[model samples]
Target: MREGAVRWLSPAGFFTMRWWEWGPEDGAPVVCVHGLTRSGRDFDALARHLAGAGRRVICPDLPGRGASDWLPDPMLYQPAVYIAALSHLLARLDGPVDWVGTSLGGICGMGIAAMAGHPIRRMVLNDVGAFVPKKAMARIRDYLGTEPVFRDIPALEAHLRAVHAPFGALSDAEWRHLAETSARPAEGGIALHYDPAIAAPIRAAEAQALDMQGLWEKVRIPVLLIRGAESDLLLPETAAAMAAEPHVTLAEVAGAGHAPALMDAAQIALVAEFLAQ
Candidate 1:
């Protein structure tokens, strides 16, 4: 594991955002983003894989997750605040970057990369896209809106496995690692590392059926849409449509549901090839 400063950007003055870096300090940079309820650590395997190919990886703990400071108000956890934080990180990079985003992180990356003359040069959207199914969004709301506290690490691990069943089969070791990365000390024992209230904006967005067509159409960089074969979040039709874009490509991870872990050699190889292109 690598370490760095958990810098803060005041997107909301009351809270501070944190991000971690991996690979060489001066290596080719790749910015990675995690899913809803996940932190920067979610990209560990993918980052290591990319770093092995001589790429520096930066993974930010979006406002309310991982080591990042939690917001006093949940309303500010939306993409607007996230985009502001990412802009600060991009400024720090001082050059164009490649991006790998998973789920919610993918959506945020899509928005950033679509901006005019943005620094993003290439992107990989892992189990996410321009259109997410309404059923999946509703399912996510049901899970996120319910605040569940665990009594111990084992309990937390069990819960994480259950909640992330959509990720398909993973070993006990991987599950434990995920649990550890996703946990923080709570009053009695341990709870999720992410701020529970981060759910507010997600629920609100679902209620309004917020459309992101403008951003999707504006994407100028090479885009890779990675879908989980069984994913309810990113539909097959949407992936097909997205791949029709001149600069976009698509791949599917079999047996997964809402998302793919990208831990296997095949998935990593595909990503490496895409980045190399």
Candidate 2:
């Protein structure tokens, strides 16, 4: 594993934002963003593949997830704050970069890239688009409310399998790998790696009127939008509309839903080709 740097940025006055870098320090940089309720660790396989192709992959544990500290309020977990955090992250990089974002991460990338003078040179959005369907968002709420615990790693691993079966046909070893990285030892025993409060902002969205469709039209950067064939969040109509843009690139992965892990070679190759362009 290559060494990574930890940097803090101040967003919303009192919050200290944090992100980490991985892969070769001197190589071309690509920023990897994780989905909501997930962390930078989600990009491990993709990062390793990209690093092998001679690029520096920077993955951030979005606020309230992974090793990053939580904010005082969960409402701040929205994409706008994430866009600001990423803008700061890009500024620290000192140059334009390619981006690979999954779900919430992709939304943040889209939001920032839509603005003027954005630093993104290329983007790959995994399993998300400007329009997220009500059904998909509803399903998210079902799992997001749970605060489950387990007596041991095996039990936790079993739970992860049940909850994340949508991840497609990952091997037992693969499931074990994710389970190990995504669980933490707690006073009660083992639990998921993220803060429970992280779900608050996500659930609150049900009551708000989000205007994500308006935002997608403004993004001018070259984008590669990959959707899971079985995704409920990014409907086909929304994906088609998103791809209708002049600089958009789109792909659909089979046997996956909500998000594709970018775990396979074909997904990595598509992303690498875009970055190399």
Best by lDDT: 1
Write candidate 2's Cα lDDT for 17-51 as tens digits.
45556677888899999987777877788888888
Q: Give residue 17's lDDT in candidate 2 (0 to 100).
A: 49
Residue-level lDDT tens digits of model 1 in 12-111: 5645567777788888899888888888887788788888878899888888789877888889888878887777788888998999999888888988
Q: Estimate each model's TM-score.
A: 0.94, 0.92
Clashing residue pairs in candidate 1 (N, C-alpha, C atoms within 3 angstroms): 231-257
Query: Model 1 Cα displacement at 262 (Å)?
Result: 1.5
Candidate 2 segments exceeding 4 Å error: 3-20, 205-211
> Root-mean-square deviation of each candidate, in angstroms?
1.7, 2.0
TM-score of 1: 0.94
State the displacement of the C-alpha of residue 249, model 1, in Å, after optimal TM-score superposition. 1.0
Q: Which stretches of candidate 1 lie over 4 Å from their true place?
A: 5-11, 204-210
